[model samples]
Target: MPSVEILSRIQFAFTIAFHYIYPPLSIGLGLCLVIMEGMYLRTGIKMYEDITRFWIKIFALIFGIGVATGIVMEFEFGTNWAVYSRYVGDIFGSALAAEGIFAFALESGFLGILLFGWNRVSKGVHFFSTIMVAMGSIFSALWIVIANSWQQTPTGYIIEGEGLEARAIITDFWEMVFNPSSVDRFSHVIIGSFLAGSFLVMSVAAWYIVKKRFVEPAKAMFKVGLCVATVAALAQLFTGHRSAHYVSEYQPAKLAAMEGHYDSSAVAAMYIVGWVDAKSGKTTGIKIPGGLSFLTHGSFNAPVTGLNAFPGTERPSAVNFVFQTYHIMISIGMFLIALTLTACFLLWKKKLFSQKWLMTIFIWAVLLPQIANQAGWYAAEVGRQPWVVYGLLRTSDALSKEVKAEQVVFSLVLFSLVYTLLLVLFLYLLNKKIVHGPEMTPNEEDDSDEFSKRNIKQLQA
Candidate 1:
């Protein structure tokens, strides 16, 4: 029973949250494809080829859904956020156009060859196609993150005129692309995508192992997935630290809310586990005094700005939302790091495949990255509340004037129904694919022994 504006905002959030699920999957899967296909070429291993082919089906399915959902979001900008769109039209046009030219074209051009060209082209040619598709996915993330980070930081833009008629013009394209928050956020997103992809691959492989089906290829997938997960999880720690530093420097209000810093402090404490009492505007948790100071400023007693620096109206609208979601993301990230690193150690010890309990945990571990990704996104978007374009424009002023309450309500209901159906369809298709597993070519089956022979020492177990 919110007002029209609030309903519209909630509607958009719901649709976009649903849509956000696919891109990371596709992006992560793309990198896995590259790794698998590249290994096949280098080792001429049918096991690698099997992993590559099976995941291509998954990759294609995810990519299709991502494209579909992304299109819906684009239309929404014009429909629900018309005024905001006009204000940043030039900036969006440039970035989106670049995405199409650099990302979509490459992905689409090579995707067909990657998907359907196994029998038609040379192995080298097919591998090249996979490379392009992987690069394209990363490129897509780059431009999109750059655009979003611009909103968070409002860099390299100059506003002309005043009020409803004002527009922000890009002063320097490169500056805009590398805004204060862009590269840091971009790193976090890219690493998160890799983790997502790795976890998916790991989950399926783990399930196959537990079921005692597709043993060899599953081993191959699990090994490669472990590699990606371990490396990406470690990288995320670095990227996360840098991202937090940037947020602390440039978005103190958001940082304050994220850490639940209510009072001004020369040395800020980081909450390891915490919750906020929204009614009383008080934070409660066990925290390490000055832990945040060390993490963000490289000193235990460094001055860290707090929420009191911002006025009540300018503060984040949902402090609990930011606090809880950020902590969830951080906790999950640490868990992933520990999980992957443990798997890595066991793999080195050649005891990984025998660990049934661990495999069982990994079988359902795909959901962790999904949760972490959503939590991270929630922390980011909610922390930036009130501002649609940082300080340039408040979210209330960005709504389209022509859209009616009833129209938004109707659209929200319809979209919810359609999206629910779509979710069911997607899950059905994905389950069907997982249950069916990979189809090995006749040649791969014939060459299974040779392929298995080429699998390095670790996979020999």
Candidate 2:
């Protein structure tokens, strides 16, 4: 049996990983909703309104699931990680409070208007509501990322006690919010969310085209999705580079683990594909010599601090695991960039939709962004291993002292069963919606008062 600590960690990781799937979808879909509704208001085109209305239902479903799953982490924090919770309560409390006031309030307040206000409110008012909901989602991400980044590179707080009694007290709120890693990590996370949203759009649209249903609206949606995907995929390269630089500066040991670099005296080699023999400190792969050094320091000869620089107990234990996950994320990012860029080029040449092979690929490409997001998250969190809050606290010391291994195992099993059921239901509902297509009745497709009256009646029904 795993130790109580191990079981607890596994449980938390399982819950968080499962919960993570929906937020990116919600955030990304929020942006697409904004764009679609904006287009509706700008052009007075009923097709755009139909598209916006269709995705709003999907967005609401994702948001609900995301909220439901996210609440579990709060309980886990108190029940499984009591010590850690007490230690960082002040800091976390402030950030979460801000999320409620500035993020969730704005989002939830306007969400009803965005959803059911289609005929109840004017088009301009509805569009404004859509914009508010989108911005609110982004703000929610901003605060959450800030809190997590503080764990990575702690600042703007003072340690108030020692040993088990120690707590972090916020001294500079803005400084904490803008900690060294926060901006870069936030950008990376948000851009990744955009890719997820856009890819989902493309997948559904491509499916529609392939099935020869609602081809025109699907093309319009596909075009919007492709544009968003292209910009986001390209932006990811810059954000990833920026994040790497920050990691190299603030968390050298993690950076070393990510690349499987073990020789303190040598410039790091960046692997394209690799296997690490941690026992022997040998990493075998096709790699560019000094590639990591050059990327981090702009000099091929620059030496990077490596695993050897850290004490055995201080360095990440699962070095190879971090290396593989980090590499997988990088590889997926490159693939997305290539795929989107090529698709954009083909689109420019007017041959995009006809490319059945590429359309088929897009139909499944929704998984890539989700995979990359999960992989990147794992690499970052695991790479800092041994520490739940980086230099401030060790993960081993953060667990609730009285929690038994059996208790944790039981809860883990229960969570797994519930989450599996939730996932199945989500997929079933999503597939039903997709199959239904975005059908606009001839009466609802009109621009006159008749369209308004029909929409109101449909809403009442």
Candidate 3:
């Protein structure tokens, strides 16, 4: 049987991975909703308002599940990682309090208006509510990232006790919030959420176009999604590069593992796709010679600290796993950029929706951004393994002393069952919504008919 620590870790990973699916959707959909509502306010287009209304229902569904699943992690902290919780409580307390005050409050307060105030509130008030909800989601991400980043590169805190009694005491609240990895990681995560949300819109829109149902609104949604995906994909490249630079400077072992570098003195070659044989301390595949060096140091000859420089115990043991996941994320990012730009070109030539191949691709392409987001998250979290809180705390030592492996196993099974049911329910409702499509009044239907007639030629071509 696995130890309690192993079981607890697996349980947390399972729950968090499942829970993570919704937040990005929430954040991304929030942004998309804001855009759609803003367009409604600007142009007096009822279709945009209808589109906004449809997605708001989906967004609320995502937000509800996200909140429900997220609450599990908080409890797990106390039940499975009691020691770790005690250690980080002082630091996390302030951050969580801030999240409640600045993020959740704003988000939840306007949420009612955004959801049920359609006829009750003025159009301007409704739009304002949408904007506030989107901003609230962004703020929520900010505090969560700040807390996680502090774990990655802990600072502005000092150890106050010894051994099991030890805890991190916050020295400067601002410094802890603005830790070295916070901004870069925050931007990366937020952009990733945007990509996930936009692609979802695109996927559904593309499906509608292919089926010739609600083609007008689908085209509008597809255009908006394509626009956001393009910008986010481009920005991701810069943010990812910046993130790598920071990891190189502050977390050399993890950077080395990510690139599959082993030699202490040799210039690190960046693998395009490779296999790392940990036993042989070698990575082999097609690579750009000194590519890692050039990217990290601005020169081909610059030396990057390698895994060999760190003790075996200190290095990420799953070198190849990290390498593969990191590459997967990079590969997906490039693919999104290419896909979006191609769609944009076709759109510019007025040939976007008519292209059955492109529309079909977009129909299924929603999974790509989600896959990339999960891969990136796994790479970051797993690469930092062995250490629960970087240099300050080891994961092995963080588990609750009273917890047993059997208890953890039981809870894991229970969680798996419950989460599976949640997944099924979520899918059933989502499919129902997509199949029903956008709602339209009699006048709006006439307008859509006229709009379709104007664009029927494009569909034919």
lDDT of 1 at 95: 95
**For model 1, how many clashes?**
0
Note the residue pairs that clash in candidate 1.
none
Cα lDDT of model 3 by residue, 1-461, tens digit: 99998899889989998988998988988889989988878777677888999999999999999999999999999999999999999999989999999999999999999999999999999999999999999999899989999989999998998999999999999999999999999999999999999999999999999998887889989988988999999999999999998899889999999999998867889988999999999999989999999999999999989999989888788899999999999999999999999999999999989999999999898999888988898899889987889988988999999999999999999999999999999999999999998886445455434454433444334
Poorest 10 consecutive residues of model 3 by lDDT?
452-461
Q: Write the per-residue lDDT of candidate 1 for residues 64-174, one digit (tens) a residue.
A: 888877777888898988889989988989999999999989999999999899889999899899999999999999999989999999888889878888888999998
Question: Which pairs clash (backbone N, Cα, C closer than 3 Å) in model 3?
Answer: none
lDDT of model 3 at position 102:
100
Writing each residue's lDDT as its tens digit, candidate 2 over 314-385 gives: 889999999999999999999999999999999999999999999999999999999999999999999988
- Candidate 3 residue runs with Cα over 4 Å from true position: 446-461
Write down the RMSD of candidate 3 (Cα, Å). 2.3
Question: Against the true structure, what is every candidate's RMSD?
Answer: 2.3, 4.6, 2.3
**C-alpha lDDT values of all predictions:** 0.87, 0.91, 0.91
Worst 10 residues of 1 by lDDT: 445-454
